[model samples]
Target chain A: MKTDRTPKIGFGIRKIILALVIPFIIVLIWLYATMYTSIPHGILPTIPEVGQTFVEMLKSGQMKEDILISISRVLKGYLISAVLGIFFGSLIGMYQPVKELLVPIITVIRQIPMIAWIPLIVLWCGIGETSKVVIIVLVAFFQILVNTQSGIESTPKGYIEVAKLYKLSRWKTFTKVYLPHAVPQILVGLRLGLGGSWMAVVAAELIAATSGIGYRMSSARSNMQSDVVIVCMIVVGIVGVLMDKGIGVIFAALTPWRKVENENRKEE
Target chain B: MKEAKDEIRENDNSYIINVEHLNKQFIVDKQPMEVLHDINLKIKKGEFITIVGHSGCGKSTLLKIMCGLVDYEDGIVERNGHAVVGPGPKCGMVFQDHRLLPWLKIKDNVGFGLKNLPKQEREEKVRKHLEMVGLKGFENSYPSQLSGGMSQRAAIARGLANNPTILLLDEPFGALDALTRIQMQKEILRIQEEEKTTMVMVTHDIDEAIYLGDRIVVMSARPGEIKEIIEVDKAESRKRSGAGFAAYKKRIYDYFFEDSDVEYDVEYVI
Candidate 1:
């Protein structure tokens, strides 16, 4: 299984050159769209105009506040979601009775998309920081929970039997056998949940928030300042990419054994 | 069944493991299917016992039952005169796949069952067992870092680490190549000789049974039962290419294939 393959990290110069090709093509299209087309600047800002506005936002400290505010909100909600998801997921995964009792309702709730939860959450928590964080929790929790549950559930029967043969206590077995087996999968969940948090936070801010990057985009949209809107979008994309890479780096360090494979002794 | 119990009673407490009329059933498609029926075995302390049977003969099941890894009803299976309800520390088992936890290093996997000991004592025991299995330099290596034979050696080390009175090996070298398997067989024999621990190995390989076992229990499939028990003279059976080894192989082969149309009389006799 490719399961044991060490995730390749650290882009080479050649790799960086290859990766930048698509973005460069996209920028060429953007420059053409603004300079050559009759489309108004209000609708699609010129690349230079967007870059100038980006510098203005940075100088004003507006860019820093917006990015930091959104990041902090995502972190707060993400941590709470991670804890709740893993705790409940492990219980449901380990026990048949708990899984039977909880899974059906959770499946139904997860069907309702994150955006659909915002109006109701805004009504209940009232467009404050609580509403945004709650919306994020609602969005990210299920993603983390389902992934964690599957990871724990799919632990090899042989491994569990080994633990049982050792007569390890239930808690000890979970920690040593189930938990370690599930770590890589659990990391996948945490990454997805982090991604989900950004979506939830942005959507919540666009619909109701008074501050944050999403709010800045919407306010710029209404004022016909397309350059500011484009700048916010670029900043959001960059932050999301950075956070994703950060999670990869952290989890890689945490699970060193996963990255070490013996070429001569691949498991049968 | 009554005779079986009487036989056990006649035998002294030198027997570390005793099974009288042991029967095990598993439910398949909601039907009660017997895996082991009327199994009677008595193993003395420090004796190396090998159970030989075909695949699907429930030999592995019997080994698991002995080690308290599997439950059985309507059986008198005892380890050290105590009925085995569940797995205990004294009964260590090695499985065919070398079931080492992939996440743990060889040292951690070997020391897994050595609970409630001082740090130094546990480390010492792990080091000793790893050294015993000829895996001295691989303490820091993960299970995947080792080849199949090496992994099985680590598994054997793990089994011995707990200092169990009984070690049950269920086809422990089944996954290794022929040369590696032969090497492993020699290593296990040496380990058993040095430790003097009661070793019970289950295998489908006839030669392995003759080579290592002090007594080889030949079992038949479809509700597995002991067909015959052959005593091996260590001096004679240790010579794998000698006439005595082939003679034992011939006898075990008859127990497995005699009922079938394949003729073995000409091929076996010199």
Candidate 2:
């Protein structure tokens, strides 16, 4: 309507092509390597074979079940950690006594790798999904807590001064000023926590689990079903990308002012 | 025009802010270092005063004291005949840094200090000040999206949105480019004329002091004290580059730059 002179990059065709580039390159290299190589048959499982395996797996709903299990655990563990971490983080952020007492404990726990807790967790909780959830929560909670505290601490002092001068109630100041200021940082923390929990869940499942993508991969490895394992890995990659992009979209929706700023920069 | 405003205010002996024998000393590693010494100054009903000094001078600290943002070692600051304890909405301030909440839109930032007010009223007040600062259409834009001059204007709009009786500006336009700085000075002067709020600005620019200040108060470097207060009778005409403007500029320059031995038409009040 306004002459539409600005050259906008099309997300439709361009995005599809961009998304396919890595897979295309991988398939091309696989085809070329298999075509001229002296590799034994059925051992390498050429690109076409893997594609066939992927279609068969999709049709049989093996991929779907594994994905659902993984997602459910990630969602449960990540959500719980997000709630608890923000509550405790804010408490520590606002009070010096709480911060001094808890910070050292948090730091020590955070230093211990997520995998380091896997054996103990499995032994304590048994192979029931409890251990996997515990691992995910452990990995995610630290990220959420650290980031939330950092976000609260980094809020500008001038804004707080303005709040005090305006005679805003303590609750109002936290909700209106402090909360909005910390949104972007806290969102980043959530993103990191969710992604970290995803990795931890998969690892925990790999070690001890009855069902999940990680369990499927372990079984496929034992049966020498490399194509199935590769398919599971692809599913993991795709799901991770989707989750990250979904969070990014949510960020844009919540903070439209950022979009305006980006458009301004492009004009400049 | 200025004389008429002063004359009208002369009949009402109501002093909005009274500062008496204010002294400030910063304890730097257990050493009592004095910055402001026996600084006794009074701002009447609707006066526009500007303080100009060098970097080390305590102009900023004095401004903090005036806004009750920082405490002084010894002072009696009374607002409306009541002793000042801490920052109140009666005094509004704008720092050199725009200090707009990065996450907030322009309209919301202007309403930041009006958090206690009703939502509809706050929104209306924010709109009025946005229009006053010529940012009518940029209500939804963030501080990051604004130019340096525009952000500073938004900062001024935020300060004035509170509608305080006394406005404290601490070198608000010092961060802008030369051209933008000049434009902002003119904009602020026009706003002050319209608002008629008692204003105290701290600046290091002598030319800026001459351009915007109705009266310039110069402070000495260490243990900052008011060295001279020069009244610019023809400030409107002095803003332009003419002989009268040059004479007034020379008077302030002499007060700050000239040796004590130099003879000038400066009346030392303290």
Candidate 3:
């Protein structure tokens, strides 16, 4: 079985480079077109202008303040939703009565997008931090809830039977068997929730925020400073990727067994 | 012959598990479907009993019922004279798929049932059982890192680590390749002899039933019932190809296919 399929270090590096090649080409095209074309700077800023604005924002400390505020809001909202979602999701998944009573209501509520509730939420919470956080929570809650419930539900019956045979206590079974089985799915939900939180926070900021990456973009748009808008967009995209990669690292740590399977698939 | 076996069981106080008039039914498509009927079995202490039958014969259900993983509407299942109400530590079960937790290391998987024990004692038992199952060095490995046979071995170790009075196996080797299945058969036999643990296993393989079981319980399908119980009446080192073994296989085959029109293809080039 130990054949030529073992991936070489150089090969892996080449694959990484190959993945970046297309993005590199796209950026190159954007730079060439903006620099060479007759398009106005107000409509489409050059790459150097966006880069200059990014550095200036970083040095001025205004960008840092906005990023910190947005991150704190996202964290507050995401953490609340994650805790509540997993807690209630596990209960609904494990108990039939809870599921029957709440699933229909949850399904109906999930159908209403987070943005749709912004008006009502702002009216209730008065366009404050509370309203923004609530919006982010609504966005993050459904994905985590659904994924956590499905993860718990889809735990292999065989493992449950083994737990039964050993006469494991309910708590023991949940922690040792069900929780471990659901980790991968739960992580997936968290990643998705994180993404939703970013989107929701940005939308909330665009509508009413005093300071955030989204608010910065909104102000720049009205002021026709496209360089600042582009800079904010780049920051948002990079931050989202970084957050996702952070979750990926945690997931790999929790599920080392899956890493081996993934490597085998790569070999195949 | 059945009466004689019952008499022997009545005379001895060594029976660890007893089932009488066990009946089970399932609701399928809003219709009641009987799965097991009038199933009677007695497994003595330290005895190895293998129940063999066709698919849908309710043999696996029977094992589940014994392990208290399934409930039967009517029947008396007694473990050491006490009625089985639910799953308890007295019975450990091994499933067809080596259901070792993928997130747990082999040692942790084996020690799963020993949660009530002290950490040191549980670790000792886990190590001993892992060594017995020929998985000494693979303790730290995850189930995904192990091969199918190795994972199954870890599962058996987990079953045995609990030190249950009886171990119930549901087609434990059914998923293995032929050679690994044979090896696992020998491994189980050795474990059974060493531990002297009572074992009741369900299998579809007739040869495996004869090879490992002290008494082979043949079940019939379509509302499964015990058709016959044949005592191997041979030493532990009995030969598979010997005439005595062939005679037992013939008897079981006759009990299963005697009334059916199934033709046997005995001629082979090799």
**What's model 3's lDDT at B20?**
91
Comparing 1 and 3 on DockQ, the stronger one: 3
Candidate 1 vs candidate 3, TM-score winner: 1
**Can you write out model 2's per-residue Cα lDDT over A133-208, one digit (the tens) per residue?**
8899899888988888887878788778767666778887788777777777788888999899889988888888
Lowest-scoring 10 consecutive residues by lDDT in candidate 1 chain B? B261-270
Give model 1's docking category: medium
TM-score for each predicted model, relative to the true structure: 0.94, 0.87, 0.93
- lDDT value for candidate 3? 0.87
lDDT per residue (tens digit) for residues B110-185 in model 3: 9988866888899999999999999999988888888889998999999989788899999999999999999999
DockQ of each: 0.70, 0.42, 0.72
Top candidate when judged by TM-score against the true structure: 1
Can you rank all candidates by TM-score, best first? 1, 3, 2
Candidate with the greatest lDDT versus the true structure: 1
Error of 3 at B171 (Å): 1.4
Tell me what fraction of the real C-alpha contacts between chains A and B each candidate also makes.
0.81, 0.51, 0.81
lDDT of each: 0.90, 0.83, 0.87
lDDT of 3 at A162: 78
Off by over 4 Å in 1: A1-14, A262-268, B1-10, B259-270
Chain B, per-candidate TM-score:
0.93, 0.89, 0.93
Task: Give the Å error, residue B229, model 1.
Answer: 1.2
- Residue lDDT tens for model 1, A106-221: 99999998999888998899988999899999988888899889999999999999999988899999999998988888899999999999988988999998999999999988
